[model samples]
Target: MMLASSCRRFYADGSLAPWGVLLAILDIWALVNIFGKPWDLSKKLIWAAIVFFFPFGGLILYYLFGRNSS
Candidate 1:
C-alpha cells in the first residue's frame, strides 16, 4: 500500500519546475564558460550581472540594459 501510494504521488506531478530548469540552464552556461569556451566580453559581463542579481529582476535588467540589438 505504501509503495502504491508513493507511486501515485510521484506520478501526480508530471511537470518539471521552471526554477529548476532555469538553474540547470544557468549551471550549463557557467560550465560552458568555465570548462568549454570563453565568452565574449560583453556577453560575459551580462552573465555576471544576471548571476549577481538573481531570481527575476536580473533577467529584466539584462533584457533591458545588457542586450544589444545589433
Candidate 2:
C-alpha cells in the first residue's frame, strides 16, 4: 500500500523512470547526430521530427540506417 502510493507520487509529476531516462538520452544522441551531419535542412528537420515523435524506434532507425548515410 505505502509502496504503491510512493510510486504513484514519483510518477505523478511527469517525471521519467529509469528506462524513460535512457530513452531520453538515446533521443538526445540521435538528435545530436542528426544535427551534426552535413545533411540538408529538410532532411535534418525530418529526422528531428521522427526523433521527437517516436523516441525509441526513431533512434533505432537513425542509428541503423541514417547514421551510416551521413
Candidate 3:
C-alpha cells in the first residue's frame, strides 16, 4: 500500500522527470547486473556493453522495445 501510494505520488507530483526516471532505472539496472546471478560469458559481455557504452540510451531502448508485455 505504501509503495503504491508513493508511485501514485510520483506521477502526480511530476518531480520525477522522464529522463531522471530513466537515469535512475538505468543505474539500478547496472547495479543489478553487477550483483545478480552469474551469467554465461556472452550474456555478461552483452550486459557490460550496455552498461558501459550508452547505459542511459541502452536502458531507454530496452524499456521501449523489449519491455512490451502483452
Candidate 4:
C-alpha cells in the first residue's frame, strides 16, 4: 500500500515538470540547429557537448553567440 501511494505521488508530481519539458525541447532544438550550422565538425561537436551538459545556459549562449545566423 505504501509503495503504491509513493508511486502515485511520483506520477502526480509530473515526472517531467513544465521547466523540464521546456528544457528538453530547447535542447533538441539546439542540437538540430547546431548540426545545420556551417561550423566544422570539431566546433559542432564542442557546441553539442556544451548543450548536452549545460542545457539551458548552453542554448542561450548558442543562440546569442555561437550560432552563425546565416
Candidate 5:
C-alpha cells in the first residue's frame, strides 16, 4: 500500500518511471548476488533484509560494503 502510493508520487506522470525501473532491477540483481555469496545463511539473510527494506540506500551499502565481503 505505502510502496505503491510512494511509487505513484515518484512517477510524476511517468517521467520518473525509468529511475524506478532501474532501481527495481538493481535490487533484483543485488538479491541474486547476495544469495549466491558464500557467506553464512544468517549473513545472507541480514543483507537480504537490508536490500529488501531499503532499495537504493541498500544497493549503495551492498556495493560499498557487501561486495567483495565474504
Candidate 6:
C-alpha cells in the first residue's frame, strides 16, 4: 500500500521523473561512446557489460579511465 502510493506520486500526471530521464540519457551516451572506440572486441564487451550492469558507476569509471585507454 505505501509502495503503491509512492509510485503513483513518482509518476504523477503521467509525467516521467526528471532524474530518471537524465540518467537514461547519460547511460545511452556512455554506451554510444563505448562502442565507438577502436577498442579490442573483448575490452569493448567488458566495458559494455559494466555500463549495462552498473549504469551510474559505470559512466563514472568509463569517463575516468576507459575513455583515455587505448
Best by TM-score: 5
**Residue lDDT tens for model 1, 1-59:** 21122122233376545555564465445434433335566767656655444624454
Cα lDDT of model 3 by residue, 1-70, tens digit: 2112223334556565565565666656664654353655666556555544555665555456433422
C-alpha positional error of residue 22 in candidate 4 after TM-score superposition, expressed in Å: 1.0
lDDT for 18 (candidate 2):
66
Candidate 5 per-residue lDDT, tens place, 1-70, comes to 2134334436556565766767777888999999999999999999998888888778899999998986
Tell me the whole-model lDDT of each prediction, alpha carbons only.
Answer: 0.46, 0.72, 0.51, 0.71, 0.79, 0.74
Any runs in candidate 1 off by more than 4 Å, and if so which? 1-16, 23-47
TM-scores of the models, in the order given: 0.33, 0.76, 0.37, 0.73, 0.80, 0.75
For model 6, give the 10-residue run with minimal summed lDDT.
1-10
lDDT per residue, candidate 2, 12-62, as tens digits? Answer: 567656666666777888888899999999999998887777776778788
Error of 2 at 10 (Å): 8.0
Query: lDDT score, residue 60, model 4?
Result: 84
What's the alpha carbon RMSD for model 2?
Answer: 7.7
lDDT of 6 by residue, 10-55 (tens): 4656765666566667878888998999988899999988777776
TM-score of 5: 0.80
Q: What is the lDDT of residue 15 in candidate 6?
A: 67
Clashes of each: 0, 0, 0, 0, 0, 0
In model 1, state the lDDT of residue 52: 47
**Model 2: worst 10 consecutive residues (lDDT sum):** 1-10
Candidate 3 segments exceeding 4 Å error: 1-25, 62-70
lDDT of 2: 0.72
